[model samples]
Target: MIVVTTPTGQIGSQLVHRLLDQDKEVRVIVRDASRLEDTVRERVETVEGSHDEPGVLDEALPGAEALFWLVPPSRQAPSVREYYLGFARVGAAAVARHGVGHVVGVSSAGHGWPTPAGVLSAAFAMDAELGASGAAYRALSMPFYMENLLGQLDAIRGPGAFHLTCAGDLPLASIATRDIAGVAADLLTDLSWTGQRNLPVFGPDRLTPDGMAEVISQELGRPVTYRRMSMDDYASLLRSRGAGDQQVKDMTEAFAAQDHGIYDADWATAEPTSTDFRTWCREVLRPAADA
Candidate 1:
């Protein structure tokens, strides 16, 4: 059996379907089993509880060959590091206890950077804790997600623009979540690969926010632009949207790290993954913008 966490999320949902397509025996730990589609619910074994809960993974991990792990975002946590490490520690203990053979985890790019990177730092800590578990591990180290633009669908549709704290003219590496799912599915299914390593998943194009806007305009057939917001203004916006103070602060630090090139190390050396920005914009964003 293979176990998946956050099975209803964008990446997890896609990963689950891909695993099913391969005829893999799958089980998922989810908060609400009802949120899964009727067809999906009928197919997989369901462990209905948060993965971080005391006994949830204990119930799900036994006899599983491999596990796909993702820490769901939590905005209410007091400290970002503690919040992420809490989940990782639980997952590590479960993996060690059950003797699961392989584990694949969702993580960010800045694993060994010298500076403190807030949420990115938290993810690095997660990788460390999980690596200590006896299971063979693969940490999918990802850069910026292109799907993050979906959060600004309203801005793109209404004012024909998107906003971010990064420099509009500086190119940054990014990947579609679907591609990340594809990579994870491949790793989880093929348990032959052993030991711990970071797999950098990046899209073919390194596009600036302005360049992205140009592609979005071409795909959507509307004039869209990129607007750079100050870090202070970004924090204010997050706070206005009801994000906790520490969450806002951590996010701000993450963006600051990005601005300082936290993703540059892996991006410079890694082979590009399957999806490109233009294709993602045409296939994913265009449809969302139209809707």
Candidate 2:
């Protein structure tokens, strides 16, 4: 049996489907089993509860061959590091107890980055805790998620533009969540590999925000632009949208780390994944924009 966490999320949903396609025996830990598609719910064993809870994993992990782990975000947490590490610590203990053979985790790409990266730094810490587990671990490291643009869909439709705190000219490495899910599914199914390592899942494109705007305009057949917001203004916007002080601070620091080239070194050396920005814009963004 293979266990998946956050099975209803964008990445996890896709990974679950891919595993099913391969005829893998799958089990998922979710807050609401009803949220899963009827077909998916009928096919997989369901353990209804938050994966961060010890009891949930204790119920789901026994006899499981491999596990796909992802820490769902918590904006209300007092500290970002503690929030991520809390989930990781629970997962690590469960892995050791269950004697699960392999573990695949979702993580960011700034492993040796010199500066603190807020949420990204927290994810790296989670990796450390999980790696220490006796199970063989693969940290699926990635850069910016292109799906983040979906959050600004309203701005894209209203003002024909997208906004970010990072510099418009600096090259940004990004990957589609579907690609990340694909990589995870492949790793989880093939448990022959051993030991702990970071596998970088980067897309083929290296487009700056300005270049991204140009592609969006061409793909959507509308004049879209890139707007660089000040870090202070971004924090104010997050506050206005109900983000807590800790969340606001962590997000600001993450963006600052991005602007400081946290993902630059890794992206420069890694093999790019199948999806490119233009293809993702045409396939994912264009349909969302039209809707």
Candidate 3:
């Protein structure tokens, strides 16, 4: 059995489906089972509770051979890094106790940069804690998800462009969540690789926000642009969207790092890729826009 966390989330949900398609015995820990479809709940062993709790994994991890770890976003988190580390500590203890052999975690780029990483720091810390546990670990390192654009669906459809705080002309690393999930599912299914490793999952093409808008415009047969907003304006927009104070702060730091070209190195050391932004827009965003 493989234990999957965040079973109802975008990537986790897709990962569970892929695992099930491979006929792997699947179990999931979710706070609300109602959020899952009836087919998923019926097929997988369900543990309804917060995965960050002390005893939650004790019940979920035993008899499970592999684990898919993802730290779900918490808007109201007091400190993003602390909240993430708290859960990682719990998960590492449980993995050690349960003797799980393999772990595939959703991680990010920028392993040891000189700047503030915002929430990406949590992923790095979790990778270290889990890797030291002696389990065969694969840190599925990814960049800014192209799926993040879905959140700005209204802006894309209304203003015919996407907004960001970083330079629009500078290319940055990015990937599709489906590709992440697909690679993760493949890793979780096989126990062939041992020890810890960071697998980069940057998408096929390196495109700037402006370049992305151009591809999306071509795909949709309409004009779309990349609008670079001021950092203060970006923070205000996030706040107006009901984001918590900590979220505002973290995102502000993230944008600052982006503005400084911190993640630029990710493109230099990118991994083999499959889907690019244009394909992603055609396959994913176009439908979202149509909806």
Candidate 4:
């Protein structure tokens, strides 16, 4: 059986679908299993709880042959790194105790870099703990999600401009969450458990935020401009939106890292995705415009 964490999330939802398609016995850990679609709920066993809950993972790990792990974004953590590493240690202990055969963890690109990227420190920490686990592990390192552009959708639909804090062009190896989940499904079904391996799941093309504006323009039938904001200005905007100062600082630093070419390393080639940005915009964003 394969056990999945964060099954209600974008990638996790897709992964569950892929696993069910293969007729694999699947177990997913979620705070509310009833929130999933009827099909997903019917196809998999559901374990209720958050990843942060003590002893919850241990209860979920036993008898599972493989585990797909991810730490979802959280605003409540006082220190993001500490929160991430704590989850990592708990997951590692659970895997060790259960003798799970393999673990495929979703991590970020540039986790191999020694110089950490501020609050994204969790990605690096996750990689380390997953590697330390004696189970067969695959750390799927990914670039920014194309869905991150969902934040710019409102401006694309309205009279205003799409804004970013990144200076110059951020040539992101933008990938679809579906593609990442497909790869995870492949790893879970196709092979026997091995030791740790880092896999970069880059999409076929690289795109900057400015390039994204072009895509939005083509789909929306309007000219969308990409405007870069100063780091402080972006931080201030986030604060005005009710974000704490630390969260604002974290976002600002992440943007600064992007500006300085932090994640410019060689991205690993991933399996082809049928749903590129154009297809995604047509199917997902267009409908969102009506709502």
- Best of the candidates, lDDT: 2
Looking at candidate 2, what is the lDDT of residue 218? 96
- Against the correct fold, how does model 3 do in TM-score? 0.94
**Each model's total of backbone clashes:** 0, 0, 0, 0
Give one digit per residue, the lDDT tens place, for model 3 in 57-96: 9999989899999999877787888888888888988999
Model 3, residue 119: C-alpha shift (Å): 1.3
Global Cα RMSD, each model:
0.9, 0.9, 1.6, 2.0
Ranking by lDDT: 2, 1, 3, 4
> Which is the winner by TM-score between candidate 1 and candidate 3?
1
Q: Candidate 1, after superposition: displacement of residue 138 in Å?
A: 0.7
Better of 1 and 3 by lDDT: 1
Q: What is candidate 1's lDDT per residue for 155-214, written digit by digit as tens?
A: 999999999889999998899999999999889887899999988989999789999999
Residue pairs of candidate 4 with colliding backbone atoms? none
- lDDT by residue for model 2 over 146-218, one digit each (tens)? 9999999999989999999888998899999999999999999888999999888899997999999999999
TM-score to true structure, per model = 0.98, 0.98, 0.94, 0.92
Query: TM-score of predicted model 2?
Result: 0.98
